[model samples]
Target: MIKVGDKMPAGTFTQITKDGPQKISAEDFFKGRKVVLFSVPGAFTPTCDAKHLPGFVEKAGDIKAKGVDVIACIAVNDAFVMKAWGKAQNTDGKVEMLADGNADYTKALGLDMDATGFGMGVRGQRFSLVVDNGVVKQVNVEQKGEFKVSSADHVLTQL
Candidate 1:
């Protein structure tokens, strides 16, 4: 598993937001800015919907105040689902919701989990990374079904 101080892998993915489809690349998103990216197993899941994503949404402003350029949420779902989930969370313009539909980025980062028994093929483990200039400054990966270190408050403290 990747850890704190590791450089972020180069990757790209497309996402659909309230505006439209947008293609995002690692360089464009995190190369020169401070980014706090959180990945979840899936969108609309209980913990993701109720806690993970919402926590980011609630602290997006405070995070920016601390010099974060972007607060992004990534999940192993399609753009439509990501978009809808963002809307449902009332995070239409606040958080940038990205879809890793094929788990390309997730696998590259060595963060993919096999949840076949539960019907999810390959999903991203719940994790958060602080990226500065394309390098990972810190990483917080949650243990299975736990959401402590990856919470927004926890990352804020690190900041």
Candidate 2:
């Protein structure tokens, strides 16, 4: 897994907007910026929908007040699903819903979890990382089926 002081891996994530799907590169997104990047195994899952995503959405302003430039949520789903979820959760412009459809970015970060037993295939492990100008400053990764460290409140305390 990526550790503190490590640079974020180079990869592309998709975001669906009114302008349609756009490809965003991690290099472009994180360079010269302090960003909070959090990942969920899949979009609209129980814990993710009920707690993870909403916590970040609710605390986005607090996070930005600490000098965060971007607050992003990544999931192993398509851009369409991300867009819909963002709208449903009222995160339209508050959080950037990034789609790691192929799990390229997840695997590159070494945070890919084998959820085959759950019939979900390869998905990202629940994680939150603070990245400043492309380098990781802090990381919190949740254990299998757990939701302790990688949370908005926890990341806020780290900030």
Candidate 3:
């Protein structure tokens, strides 16, 4: 799994914007910036939609006030789904929703989780990272069926 001090791997995520869908590269996104990247098992899941994503949206200003350049939420759903979820969560100008549709980036970070038993296929585990200039500064990976550390409040303390 990705840990503190490890550099973010090469990867790409699909981001849907007002213009259209755009391919966002990890390099360009994290380069020379302090980013708060959070991942959810899947989009629109109970915990994710009810708490995970909403918490970040509520605390975005507080987080950015601490020098975070970007705050992003990633999931193993498609760009269209992510865009819709973002809208539903009212994440505009707060959190950037990134779609890792193929699980490529999640696997690259060693954070991919098998949810076949749950009929959700491969998904990224619930986790959060504070990455600065492409290198990880802090990491919070939640245990299965738990939402303790990888939360907006917890990350704020870390920052």
Candidate 4:
């Protein structure tokens, strides 16, 4: 798993735009920026929809006030689904919803979780990281079926 002082792994993420889905490389996104990147098992999942994404949206201002440049939420879903989830959560101008439909970025970070038993197939684990200019500052990965350290409130304290 990625740890403090390590540069983010090379990968690409899909994000929705006015024109269409745009591909953003990890290096490009993390370079010269302080970012709070959070991941979920899937978009529109019960806990995620109810708490995870909402907490970030609520605290985006507070988080950005602490010198963070970007706040992003990623999930193992298509770009359309992620975009819709962000819209439903009212995250406009706050959280950037990222799509990791192929699980490439999750596996690269060693944060992949198997959810085949739940009929969800491969998915990213619930986690969050603070990255500054492409280097990791903090990483919080939740335990199985648990939500604790990876929360927006928790990350705020760390910031």
Best by lDDT: 3
Which residue segments of model 4 deviate by more than 4 Å?
A: none
Model-by-model lDDT, in order?
A: 0.88, 0.93, 0.97, 0.95
The parts of candidate 1 lying over 4 Å away from their true place are 17-20
Q: Give TM per candidate.
A: 0.94, 0.97, 0.98, 0.98
Q: For model 4, how does the per-residue alpha-carbon lDDT over 81-159 read when each residue is reduced to its tens digit?
A: 9999999999999999999999999999999989999999999999999999999999999999899899999999999
lDDT (10s digit) by residue, model 1, range 1-159: 667777777888788745887888877888789999999999988899889999999998888888898888998999989988988998865788889999999999898999898998899999999888888988899999899999999999988
Model with the higher TM-score, candidate 2 or 3: 3
TM-score of 1: 0.94
TM-score head-to-head 1 vs 2, winner = 2
Q: What is the C-alpha RMSD of each candidate to the true structure, in Å?
A: 1.5, 0.8, 0.6, 0.6
Order candidates by lDDT, high to low. 3, 4, 2, 1
lDDT of 2 by residue, 66-117 (tens): 9999999999999999998998899965789999998999999999988889
Residue 102, candidate 1: C-alpha displacement in angstroms: 0.7
Q: Which stretches of candidate 2 lie over 4 Å from their true place?
A: none
RMSD of 1: 1.5
